[model samples]
Target: MRVLRKRMDKPAHLGGVLRDALKASSLDVDLDLYRLWEQWTDLVGPVIAQNARPAAIKGKLLLVNVSSAPWMQQLQYLKSEMMEKLNSALEREAVKDIRFKIGPIE
Candidate 1:
Protein backbone atom coordinates (compact mmCIF):
# COMPACT_ATOMS: atom_id res chain seq x y z
CA MET A 1 0.00 0.00 0.00
CA ARG A 2 1.13 3.57 -0.79
CA VAL A 3 0.26 6.88 0.95
CA LEU A 4 -0.12 10.23 -0.86
CA ARG A 5 0.07 13.68 0.61
CA LYS A 6 -1.38 16.96 -0.66
CA ARG A 7 0.74 20.12 -0.77
CA MET A 8 -0.48 23.36 0.84
CA ASP A 9 0.33 26.86 -0.37
CA LYS A 10 0.95 29.89 1.79
CA PRO A 11 -2.08 32.07 2.43
CA ALA A 12 -2.24 35.57 1.00
CA HIS A 13 -3.26 38.56 3.05
CA LEU A 14 -6.87 39.64 2.64
CA GLY A 15 -5.90 43.16 1.52
CA GLY A 16 -3.45 41.83 -1.05
CA VAL A 17 -6.00 39.35 -2.35
CA LEU A 18 -8.64 42.06 -2.67
CA ARG A 19 -6.20 44.38 -4.44
CA ASP A 20 -5.29 41.63 -6.91
CA ALA A 21 -8.94 40.89 -7.60
CA LEU A 22 -9.82 44.56 -8.08
CA LYS A 23 -6.86 45.00 -10.44
CA ALA A 24 -7.72 41.86 -12.40
CA SER A 25 -11.28 43.09 -12.90
CA SER A 26 -10.15 46.70 -13.59
CA LEU A 27 -12.45 47.68 -10.73
CA ASP A 28 -9.97 49.66 -8.62
CA VAL A 29 -10.76 52.94 -10.37
CA ASP A 30 -14.46 52.22 -10.43
CA LEU A 31 -14.39 51.42 -6.75
CA ASP A 32 -12.63 54.67 -5.98
CA LEU A 33 -15.15 56.60 -8.07
CA TYR A 34 -17.97 54.85 -6.29
CA ARG A 35 -16.39 55.81 -2.99
CA LEU A 36 -16.43 59.44 -4.08
CA TRP A 37 -20.10 59.14 -4.91
CA GLU A 38 -20.81 57.39 -1.64
CA GLN A 39 -19.03 60.10 0.32
CA TRP A 40 -20.57 63.03 -1.55
CA THR A 41 -22.63 64.29 1.36
CA ASP A 42 -19.81 63.96 3.84
CA LEU A 43 -17.36 65.70 1.54
CA VAL A 44 -19.54 68.51 0.14
CA GLY A 45 -21.85 69.16 3.08
CA PRO A 46 -25.60 68.66 3.21
CA VAL A 47 -26.73 71.74 1.25
CA ILE A 48 -24.77 71.05 -1.91
CA ALA A 49 -25.14 67.33 -1.52
CA GLN A 50 -28.90 67.69 -1.36
CA ASN A 51 -29.12 69.84 -4.48
CA ALA A 52 -26.65 67.87 -6.57
CA ARG A 53 -25.64 64.25 -6.94
CA PRO A 54 -22.63 62.63 -8.50
CA ALA A 55 -23.68 60.89 -11.68
CA ALA A 56 -20.43 59.52 -13.10
CA ILE A 57 -16.70 59.94 -13.53
CA LYS A 58 -15.10 60.05 -16.95
CA GLY A 59 -11.34 60.44 -16.86
CA LYS A 60 -10.73 63.27 -14.38
CA LEU A 61 -14.10 64.91 -15.01
CA LEU A 62 -17.05 64.38 -12.69
CA LEU A 63 -20.63 64.51 -13.97
CA VAL A 64 -23.22 65.82 -11.55
CA ASN A 65 -26.98 65.84 -11.70
CA VAL A 66 -28.48 68.97 -10.23
CA SER A 67 -32.05 69.29 -9.03
CA SER A 68 -32.67 72.49 -11.02
CA ALA A 69 -31.08 74.89 -13.46
CA PRO A 70 -30.49 77.53 -10.78
CA TRP A 71 -28.73 75.00 -8.62
CA MET A 72 -26.71 73.85 -11.61
CA GLN A 73 -25.65 77.41 -12.27
CA GLN A 74 -24.78 77.93 -8.64
CA LEU A 75 -22.69 74.76 -8.65
CA GLN A 76 -20.92 75.91 -11.81
CA TYR A 77 -19.57 78.90 -9.89
CA LEU A 78 -18.32 76.59 -7.14
CA LYS A 79 -16.77 74.03 -9.45
CA SER A 80 -13.18 74.70 -8.48
CA GLU A 81 -14.00 74.83 -4.79
CA MET A 82 -15.98 71.62 -5.03
CA MET A 83 -13.14 69.90 -6.87
CA GLU A 84 -10.67 70.95 -4.21
CA LYS A 85 -12.96 69.77 -1.42
CA LEU A 86 -13.65 66.40 -3.06
CA ASN A 87 -9.97 65.79 -3.88
CA SER A 88 -8.99 66.74 -0.36
CA ALA A 89 -11.56 64.38 1.09
CA LEU A 90 -10.43 61.55 -1.20
CA GLU A 91 -6.77 62.27 -0.37
CA ARG A 92 -6.16 62.09 -4.12
CA GLU A 93 -7.01 64.00 -7.28
CA ALA A 94 -9.90 61.78 -8.16
CA VAL A 95 -11.93 64.57 -9.72
CA LYS A 96 -10.47 67.47 -11.69
CA ASP A 97 -13.55 69.14 -13.14
CA ILE A 98 -17.29 69.00 -12.52
CA ARG A 99 -20.08 69.21 -15.10
CA PHE A 100 -23.50 69.95 -13.76
CA LYS A 101 -26.75 69.30 -15.62
CA ILE A 102 -30.33 69.87 -14.57
CA GLY A 103 -31.73 66.48 -13.80
CA PRO A 104 -33.62 64.44 -11.24
CA ILE A 105 -31.87 64.40 -7.87
CA GLU A 106 -33.08 60.99 -6.77
Candidate 2:
Protein backbone atom coordinates (compact mmCIF):
# COMPACT_ATOMS: atom_id res chain seq x y z
CA MET A 1 0.00 0.00 0.00
CA ARG A 2 1.12 3.61 -0.78
CA VAL A 3 0.02 6.93 0.70
CA LEU A 4 -1.23 9.74 -1.56
CA ARG A 5 0.56 13.11 -1.43
CA LYS A 6 -1.29 16.30 -0.62
CA ARG A 7 -1.25 19.14 -3.15
CA MET A 8 -2.99 22.45 -3.79
CA ASP A 9 -6.17 21.93 -5.82
CA LYS A 10 -6.08 25.42 -7.28
CA PRO A 11 -3.45 27.77 -8.58
CA ALA A 12 -2.76 31.14 -6.99
CA HIS A 13 -3.66 34.35 -8.76
CA LEU A 14 -0.75 35.78 -10.76
CA GLY A 15 -1.25 39.26 -9.37
CA GLY A 16 -1.47 38.01 -5.81
CA VAL A 17 1.62 35.88 -6.26
CA LEU A 18 3.58 38.81 -7.71
CA ARG A 19 2.45 41.06 -4.88
CA ASP A 20 3.53 38.51 -2.32
CA ALA A 21 6.93 38.18 -3.96
CA LEU A 22 7.39 41.94 -4.01
CA LYS A 23 6.41 42.16 -0.36
CA ALA A 24 8.93 39.51 0.55
CA SER A 25 11.62 41.47 -1.29
CA SER A 26 10.61 44.70 0.53
CA LEU A 27 9.94 46.31 -2.86
CA ASP A 28 6.19 46.53 -2.37
CA VAL A 29 6.50 50.04 -0.93
CA ASP A 30 8.62 51.10 -3.88
CA LEU A 31 6.03 49.69 -6.27
CA ASP A 32 3.29 51.66 -4.50
CA LEU A 33 5.39 54.81 -4.63
CA TYR A 34 5.99 54.43 -8.37
CA ARG A 35 2.31 53.70 -8.94
CA LEU A 36 1.53 57.28 -7.92
CA TRP A 37 2.62 58.62 -11.29
CA GLU A 38 -0.03 56.66 -13.17
CA GLN A 39 -2.66 56.87 -10.45
CA TRP A 40 -2.12 60.50 -9.54
CA THR A 41 -5.15 61.76 -11.44
CA ASP A 42 -7.35 59.16 -9.80
CA LEU A 43 -5.85 59.53 -6.31
CA VAL A 44 -6.06 63.28 -6.35
CA GLY A 45 -8.35 65.30 -8.63
CA PRO A 46 -8.03 66.12 -12.28
CA VAL A 47 -7.36 69.75 -11.41
CA ILE A 48 -4.55 68.98 -9.01
CA ALA A 49 -3.24 66.25 -11.30
CA GLN A 50 -3.01 68.75 -14.09
CA ASN A 51 -0.95 71.09 -11.96
CA ALA A 52 1.32 68.60 -10.32
CA ARG A 53 2.66 65.07 -10.78
CA PRO A 54 4.72 62.65 -8.71
CA ALA A 55 8.34 62.80 -9.79
CA ALA A 56 10.38 60.55 -7.51
CA ILE A 57 10.61 58.90 -4.13
CA LYS A 58 13.32 59.24 -1.49
CA GLY A 59 12.78 56.83 1.35
CA LYS A 60 9.35 57.82 2.70
CA LEU A 61 9.29 61.23 1.11
CA LEU A 62 7.51 61.82 -2.21
CA LEU A 63 8.82 64.36 -4.69
CA VAL A 64 6.32 66.10 -6.94
CA ASN A 65 6.69 68.45 -9.86
CA VAL A 66 4.34 71.41 -10.07
CA SER A 67 3.56 73.42 -13.18
CA SER A 68 3.98 76.80 -11.52
CA ALA A 69 4.94 78.57 -8.33
CA PRO A 70 1.31 79.12 -7.38
CA TRP A 71 0.61 75.46 -7.91
CA MET A 72 3.64 74.49 -5.84
CA GLN A 73 2.48 76.83 -3.06
CA GLN A 74 -1.02 75.44 -3.26
CA LEU A 75 0.30 71.89 -3.00
CA GLN A 76 2.06 72.80 0.26
CA TYR A 77 -1.32 73.23 1.93
CA LEU A 78 -2.57 69.95 0.50
CA LYS A 79 0.55 67.93 1.26
CA SER A 80 -0.86 66.17 4.29
CA GLU A 81 -4.15 65.50 2.56
CA MET A 82 -2.35 64.18 -0.50
CA MET A 83 -0.17 61.98 1.65
CA GLU A 84 -3.27 60.55 3.28
CA LYS A 85 -4.85 59.94 -0.11
CA LEU A 86 -1.68 58.33 -1.42
CA ASN A 87 -1.37 56.03 1.58
CA SER A 88 -5.02 55.19 1.25
CA ALA A 89 -4.63 54.42 -2.44
CA LEU A 90 -1.65 52.15 -1.79
CA GLU A 91 -3.46 50.58 1.16
CA ARG A 92 -0.37 51.29 3.28
CA GLU A 93 1.64 54.18 4.66
CA ALA A 94 4.18 54.42 1.88
CA VAL A 95 4.48 58.17 1.93
CA LYS A 96 5.40 60.08 5.08
CA ASP A 97 5.70 63.53 3.48
CA ILE A 98 5.47 65.34 0.12
CA ARG A 99 7.89 67.85 -1.39
CA PHE A 100 6.97 70.04 -4.36
CA LYS A 101 9.11 71.83 -6.91
CA ILE A 102 8.28 74.01 -9.91
CA GLY A 103 8.90 71.85 -12.97
CA PRO A 104 7.33 70.64 -16.18
CA ILE A 105 4.29 68.50 -15.60
CA GLU A 106 4.60 66.71 -18.90
Separate clash counts for every candidate? 0, 0
Predicted candidate 2 versus true structure: per-residue lDDT over 1-106, tens digit per residue: 9999889799889999987898787586578666887798999999998999888787788888999998888889988899999988888888998899988887
Pairs that collide in candidate 2 are: none
RMSD of 2: 6.3
TM-score of each: 0.73, 0.73
Off by over 4 Å in 1: 1-26
The regions of model 2 sitting more than 4 angstroms off are 1-30
| C-alpha positional error of residue 47 in candidate 2 after TM-score superposition, expressed in Å | 0.8
Predicted model with the maximum lDDT = 2
